[model samples]
Target: MANSSQKKIAHENTKILLALRKGFIWVNAFYIFYRIIYQWNTFELKLALGYLVSAGISILLYTQINTMGKPRYNSKGELADAGEDLTQEGLVQYAFDIIYVTWFVHVTSAFWPKMWWFYLSIPLYAGWKVWQLVVKPMLSRSGAGAASDAASESTEGTKSRRREKMENRAEKGPQVRYR
Candidate 1:
């Protein structure tokens, strides 16, 4: 019963994530079209190329998140484990959201310099994401072995009551009883 409840929760969460993903894609598409149709005269070659590249990236990420969020099934038709957590993909989508907003502000700031500050957030957020998703994992992987060994050593000195009881039972051996 608990398992079914958990599955229900997971299913709901997936639906929400998928809805957000679709919304992001639609907004991005709208922005791209808006720029092309409304601001075509202001476009530089470099900015146009960048938009194309960004569009391609958005398509790739959308497919990747879809693949990751899909649940697998066994041959017996039972639901197997869902693929990678959607929350992580949602974070990636959020990063793209920031980038899109920054890009819009950047383009608009050509007419009004005061909005220039908003674009600064792009590098700051990107750097933070890099630190979190890439640098932290690499650092942890390099130190994980030693860290785990030290953790095990520390934990060994403090057994839980359950562990102590199990050890005591093992040391006592089985007792024979008369009927």
Candidate 2:
């Protein structure tokens, strides 16, 4: 009976977390569309730079907020708990918020509508998401694998070197390389 009740609690929590994540994601997606449509221009490069700055700030703040709740969210998230799943969704919201705010700043103050390639925003945002969330993690894992391989190779080299020294000592001679 106790186990059943605990499971129910966990399940309910997971559902809530999932819902929060979905809601945050929806907000992010909406903002992406809003920014692109509202600020269509040819000078997308400049716009992208501005967006990047805002994104940087937003990401920093977002990380700080999430980390502040690390004890609760990180562990729960790993266990597939509800509040934990919101972490990613929150990150997405943070990123889109950056872009939206930057767009707002540009349009209201420094924006020139004729300069941006607003059409590119859709693809750019999609690519950024893939690169940041998926591709980068994959690449980082690959890098770690490479590092492990290098470490293994160096360890083998050390073992072989020690064996060579022992063999040379056993043979009554200086090391000789025979072709």
Candidate 3:
């Protein structure tokens, strides 16, 4: 059926994306280690500071994403099913991915200084994520709280029939009959 074929395609896409993500992570780790271990004496202060800033941003964003309770990767290191959802968490992860790729480019640019422009994107993307994830939510909550207070005032005197029935049932407790 069409449903099964769709699922197969989705699984294949997941596998490909997961492999690419893992590959990038490993490559970045290896490059960073190589630079730090072998080229420490040649490293510029700017490059070291860039690495520290990137690492700090990465850790903070990762913790924020993790606390949202969505499992992005499974125990086998594959993408979790919910990872494909087009929800807020997914959007945040996508933004993180952008910063990640930019950070990689910034790292590589240590030798080719011409690519230094990529480093600018790291802070820009992070600022966008902060606006989307933090500031916007706080603004929305304040507006929603005022609206909810007004709505509660308007509905203060009435209980839905279903609520009334539920209350009555609670008052009666449990009933048992034997035949």
Candidate 4:
């Protein structure tokens, strides 16, 4: 029974994880594409293309490493046996945040004084999303005099509460036996 519930939750996480991955990839791709087009009139075509190429290659490499190689899981789940994999994934995102913000700040501050806030948006938005996902757990683990129960952001798909409907179906695959 317990195993069934776990498998259901894993499946749910898989769906949300896939959707979030797709959204992030698309957002970054659009940013790179827009930057190249936006700079075409001012910067030399080669310079713009160079930026586009670099961003494109980085995205490709990220996808390859994340999908083809073993995936590093997030802290939200019991998916990784020892939690090491989850921590490594967080570290990778932290490094990415540093690299992205530094690069954006450097270039935007010098070339496009009109859009400095854009440089900050990438890092700030990422940080906000991380806070949503991790802040509760971090607080709970800190353990001061007043205790707060940890709450994780549950994606709509996560089936943590297995209904009696599911329990019966698990024993016999969904052919409904009403007593």
Candidate 5:
């Protein structure tokens, strides 16, 4: 039952990640198109190349994520045991990050002369989004909790109780009743 619940949670995470990736790709593509249209006359080579590369990378990542195989589990039948796989979701995440940064640079460069501070401040918003969506979830799943260790220690009592309960169950052995 615990394994199934974990599996369900992993499945949900995968679905959410996939959806976020696809949504970001669509938004990136649209922004690139809009940039190209907006700068049709100006034609800044650096900005153009940035947009083109970002779009290409995003599309490739999307394809890879869609084609990547489902994650494997461990002896305990937990997806967390799988650690990290690189073929799909990981690559998509990396690609989307690149896309975001590239867009940030392009936009800032394009508007810097007219609105320097505003353009420079744009990345703060981008940084917040990246932290919330990408960094938080990835780190939480990876068990990188050194920063939160103190906070977690506050729950030591609850943890001890749960551990004690599990040990008691083991001592009692499996409750099996044959029909």
Candidate 6:
């Protein structure tokens, strides 16, 4: 009963987490698009770029931390040696930290702000995360990303070998007779 309840909690938490992630991505994308369209010629590249750079650095740090020092896969799709853990407990609790700081800065910039630039960092950061999570994974699956081509070839070779072995066994017929 306890195990069952634990599973239920985990399931609910996973659903909530997924919903939040999707909402964040969509909201950021739409917000960025609206701002870009609304600003058009009035866009402030300096502020946008600055915000983006700061957010990008935070994202990079967060990514490195979240990996928990796991070895990156090699060109053959094999895990490399274990590396040192860069962040303890994925510390810094990245998302809230970034949101709080950026939000504060954005609100304060109001006196001299290009409204679009203030919020631009979010979409840029979200877009990068999306690219990493979605686009890059798709590319790798399609054998387009780094190491994917070699990995796919190896996978194909493995499948063919498996098929041939199965076929060879089939030719020998069943060793046991069924009643």
Best by TM-score: 1
lDDT of each residue in 65-149, candidate 5, tens digit only: 5445345666796575322333345545665565555556555545452322343444686698799999999989667676568
lDDT of each: 0.66, 0.54, 0.64, 0.51, 0.59, 0.54
For residues 1-179, what per-residue lDDT tens digits would candidate 3 score against the true structure? 53454355456545544554575577568657777666778778877776677666666655554444343556897544433332335666575575567567656765564565676765697799899999999999999999989998999989799989999999999879799
Question: How would you encode candidate 4's per-residue C-alpha lDDT over 29-137 as one tens digit per residue?
Answer: 5545555555445655555454565456446545543453233345895444211131235555654554455455435533564454564576687789778779966
Task: Note each model's CA RMSD in angstroms.
Answer: 9.4, 14.9, 10.9, 16.3, 12.5, 18.1
lDDT of 6 by residue, 103-142 (tens): 4454444334555355566678779978998998887777
Q: Against the true structure, what is each candidate's TM-score?
A: 0.48, 0.28, 0.42, 0.32, 0.37, 0.35
Sort order, TM-score high to low: 1, 3, 5, 6, 4, 2
lDDT of 6 at 68: 39
* Model 2 per-residue lDDT tens digits across residues 21-109: 56446544554455556545543676656556654664565555444332232444533322333334565555545545544444443
**Candidate 2 lDDT score at position 61:** 51
- The CA lDDT at 88 in model 1 is 52
Q: Which is better, 1 or 2, measured by TM-score?
A: 1
* Worst-scoring 10-residue span by lDDT in model 1: 106-115
Candidate 5 clashes between residue pairs 3 or more apart in a chain or in different chains: none
Candidate 5 minimal-lDDT segment of 10 residues: 113-122
lDDT of 1 by residue, 1-179 (tens): 64584466458547856775766666666655666666778756766665566556655666666666676667997667666555555665674575466556545644544554665676787899899999999999879978988888988878789978999999999979899
Clashes of each: 0, 7, 0, 0, 0, 0
Question: Candidate 1 has which clashing residue pairs, if any?
Answer: none
Hey, what RMSD does candidate 2 come out at? 14.9
